[model samples]
Target: MPESATLPSATTKLEYLRKDLEDLRYYLDEFSAFLPL
Candidate 1:
């Protein structure tokens, strides 16, 4: 169970998650200008 973070599946999943986060951030920034805050 140790060092399981190096698994190929986990790495790919992490990449996908990171990409999604970046996309979300970009969209948020794009729309934030129209927000009341």
Candidate 2:
């Protein structure tokens, strides 16, 4: 298999996952701030 045929898709998938994780972390941070210690 040639990387020219597969690299872009793999890179895009990773980028999408990273964005999702960032959003999830942001939401968790906000939610945790509202909780009492």
Candidate 3:
């Protein structure tokens, strides 16, 4: 019962982290287009 109480917040944190990573990747991809290999 105690573990169930903590699960929602932990899942929300994980979702936020995943969204941050996706946003970071998008910005990096955009920046990389202007750089020459």
lDDT scores for all predictions?
Answer: 0.92, 0.95, 0.97
Tell me the deviation in Å of residue 35 in model 1: 0.9
Best by lDDT: 3
The number of clashing residue pairs in each candidate reads: 0, 0, 0
Estimate the TM-score of every prediction: 0.76, 0.80, 0.90
Per-residue lDDT over 1-37 for candidate 1, one digit per residue giving the tens place of the 0 to 100 score: 6567568788999999999999999999999999988
In the order shown, what is each candidate's alpha-carbon RMSD?
A: 3.2, 1.4, 0.7
lDDT of 3: 0.97
Query: What residue pairs clash in candidate 3, if any at all?
Result: none
Off by over 4 Å in 2: none
Write candidate 2's Cα lDDT for 1-37 as tens digits: 7988899999999999999999999999999999985
- Cα RMSD of predicted structure 2: 1.4
When 1 and 2 are scored with TM-score, the better candidate is: 2
Q: Which of the predicted structures, 2 or 3, would earn the higher TM-score when compared with the native?
A: 3
Error of 1 at 25 (Å): 0.5
